[model samples]
Target chain A: MKKQIIYSLKSPYRENLDVIGFTFGSGEKSACIVGSTRGNEVQQMYICSQVVHALKKLERQGEITEGRSIMVVPCINYYSMNIGKRFWTMDNTDINRMFPGYEFGETTQRIADGVFRQVQGFKFGIQLASFYQSGDFLPHVKMMKTEFSQPEKMLEFGLPYALTRKPRPYDTTTLNYNWQIWETQAFSVYSYGTETVDEKASQVSVDAILRFLSAEGIVRANVKPGYVSRIIEENTMQQVHTEHGGIFKTLVKIGDTVYEGQVLGEVYNPLDGEKICEVKADKCGTVFFIYNKPLIMQNSVAYKIVDF
Target chain B: MIQTVAENELSVNEKLKIRKNTYQNGKGKRISIVTGTHGDELEGQFAVWLVGDYIKKNIGCLNGTVDIYPALNPLGIDSITRGIPGFDLDMNRVFPGFSEGTMAECVCNAIVEDIKGSEVCVDIHASNIYLRELPQIRISRDTAESLVPLAKMMNIDFVWVHESATVLRSTLAHSLNSIGTKTLVVELGVGMRINKDLGYQLLNGIINLLYELGMWSEKPDFEVRQPIVSFDGAVGFVNSDASGVFVSDVEFGSEVEKGDVIGRVLNPLTAESEPVKAVCSGLLFTLREYPVVYGGSLIARILSREEEN
Candidate 1:
């Protein structure tokens, strides 16, 4: 195992944009984990805990041995993290979008360069994403759309749900999205709903990683493999946007089966005491996620009803 | 035209000077008042000048020393812009500014210092050109309770109670809270013009505000109507998907009902009109003066509630 230090992106008003990564093992096979991609919560803390947990589980095994090494770069946007903002406080840009990372670019692009060097990889890249508001994840792994044939790395994680998603416009240049393009198997874990840190999901993710290592030749252990889970496609997704902006008071909970035209929540207008908004599912499905923010603006997301 | 300002710093907008005056009945309350934060919203700056002229002509209204950073971002005033000069930064956003920084930061730091010692601060503003906002005093309900009752006296149309966002980097009035200063935020009239009526209204409001607090002996006449408030109060937007003369259905301040036709987005090419309606009932707070519309241009903001007696 080896330790390395790196500088962060240089923004106008803040510091701590620096990052560091630790790698273990050597040879043709390697793996990387970068969490808290978003400067807010997903990275650097809760998800970082999951990776630390995985590393601890891997340590007891005689697997990461003589030839293989693992690298971990947790919480890249320490400057934004310091300010408790979602973007670099100085430039207000997402550090995640600066990929293939730049050396002399904007504040974010510079940060992109810092982590890009750490994540160049040997075998797999697991990026955990915590949903905004209240979308409880079903323990899914979003496999590469084109690289579905290489599900072996992901399947070894042994989670209940592993669905593949095509990259969205705002999604391109992302760690996983672009990583998939280079034939690097990438997975975006929808860890848990927004603003929440669940212990259960951590255990699920950590257990999955240990199982995956044993499944591959990395670890010589009693880990079970080949007991693959269900694979869902992206076609079964439906998003619901609230028509009005106001305090979001949800009436239904996640994991609740809902039908088309179901009342998900109400937006209360403070101008006059009234419920002016009605959110309904357009198709029969199950509720997955909803926003935690009550004071929403027009066109802000309200909920996600996955059509079953 | 550069002049060495206080403590020998080069000041921008060589055309203007830091007009210092205090309003304390010989007792000195250490008051600071600023206006024209946004160049386009000139009513406040005009009102400040009017008041400033009166103070200069006679004795000061302030007890302690007073500093007036009128048009703090002078370049914004020259270009009629909302942001500070050079960096396109909103001067209001960069509060407690940095010393070794952009021009905007330099000015902001200066303003914060100018009012740092003040016990009561006031930041004045103006509405956009198309709409008329009734003269009012805006007080941060989230701050100390000492300023609440005074805010009630501003005699405006609405006393908005809003939560603080991005603290320490809030509005000028909001920033004053961190320094333990009681601040009042006032806004009225259309932007860029001196409405004689609004000008008079604002001039009198400030006088009354200070007089009530014992800064002045005379009272500024206040409007008779008690203000109104709502949550994010009454945001009613009327827009035309079709272009034409936007014939308004109701006057400003008129009560509307759900599904009521508030106006029409008319297609002048075909001489046909599409009804511009209100999906939710509310009061008509603002309307577009220019009748012609390019698709998606908003015509009005209705403060939604149709219940009018």
Candidate 2:
């Protein structure tokens, strides 16, 4: 295993910001995994660290395939992470949205350009992604339904579910979308949480990545064939939005099966603690996502259920 | 007359609404003025108020319909956030939206539908708190041929014709232009605070534009400035090389020569200062407003006179 500095920038007030990558084996750049481009994605970063640890052990045991290399970047935007900010601390910009970035552009763009230049040509790309909203997602592998994307390949991760979403206009600037456009099969692994670490969910994500690597012949390890991941389209999920804004009290968690018209959560008046409304499931399905924040806004998505 | 453009029921008893005020005298060309897509950009708030006040006082000057759509993102404006408060979505980035999409998208879609078919539209904005800008109209190259003539009459200091690649396709201006609304994006001042002078300047430009578009019968009182139109590769970006509190020695919108000392990055801990110099000779149209900056923070943007020639 070799620790490589992929990109570095000299900071005036602190140590130089460095984007480090760990490489295992040599020859073909078989895969690249990135985690936590945003600061609040602690779980994403933790999952990537575990992946790196697993890869290091596999390499030491000579389990890594010959003439194949894998690169793991555990975290970017550590400067923001150190300060507990979500985006770039200097400027509130998301590095994830500056893919195929400009060399002469802003700070985030330059960092993106430097990192993309190194990670672009890999055969496969994996990103530990988190949702924009504060929520918990069922562990899954998601792929953008681009022309270059092979959704069937996502099933190889052996997670509980494999999701394919049509790319929106804002998605074109994202790293996962750009990677696929550049001909790399890209996948985003969503764990159970973003800001908080979930040990069980982290292991699920780490095991999924290793299982994929072993299945693809990049690594030779004895691992469980996790699951026959159900193929799901992103738009097909049933969303349950709260009708009132107040304190959200969730009755069901992610992965819980529910019937149509079942009460999933309740919104209570913050001041008086009176029940404002009951959030009911519109369709019978397994809960795929749940808003974890205490305060709920009117019309905010409280839960998303996927019909099996 | 005031009209609701879009509305959504909130979790509380209240409702989130986007509204427009229309002043019409007769059947003629229609012009629309829009602002407050970003809640923190308060410069536009003053312009909206001033324009509405002027139209109400001089109703006789209105030959056609003048639609003032202020606070496009009322939720953001109410919460003082750059994007939608609860959704964390940039309202400007979800343009020409889908009716079946999320709440933000539906609202954007309704706004586009409401503003479409106007002869001309002026979308006003202010720079983020970190930077201050001179009154300017930024038009993408694709729309420049048709819009530059109209932009020249808007009385701004600079008419920046940027490459289409630099323009986000999802922006309100781009969306409106793509659908043939003839929208011009006017950016000026700094975020979160109203600049009376800049606001009045923008109001004058809008009235002049209305007069030029045949939407206003009476002539505008103020003389419009013939802006310095940008040519290819005319804008020079100046970035800071050191991170510290920057103290500017030069005024914004002032002509500067190449290598002129515009600001200095002061490191109080070490008692050291790093001079930030102008990269090219031109009109300094943009300057850093916030004092603290990182190594790569943008200090200023100079519109090169030589390149324009």
Worst 10 residues of 2 chain B by lDDT: B7-16
Error of 2 at A102 (Å): 2.4
TM-scores, all candidates, are 0.47, 0.93
**Model 1 misplaced stretches (Cα beyond 4 Å):** A6-18, A42-44, A131-137, A147-153, A193-196, A220-228, B1-309
Model 2 alpha-carbon miss at residue A298, Å: 3.1
What shift in Å separates residue A87 of candidate 1 from its native position after superposition? 1.0
In model 1 chain A, the worst 10-residue window by lDDT is A8-17
True-vs-predicted CA distance for residue A219, candidate 1, Å: 3.5
> Largest lDDT belongs to which candidate?
2
- Report how far off residue B304 is in candidate 2 (Å): 2.1
C-alpha lDDT of all candidate models, in order: 0.61, 0.89
Candidate 1 local lDDT, residue A295: 63
Off by over 4 Å in 2: A247-251, A259-263, A266-282, B11-13
Least well predicted 10-residue stretch by lDDT in candidate 1 chain B: B4-13
Q: Fnat of each prediction?
A: 0.00, 0.31
What's every prediction's RMSD, in angstroms? 23.4, 2.4
TM-score of chain B of each: 0.77, 0.97
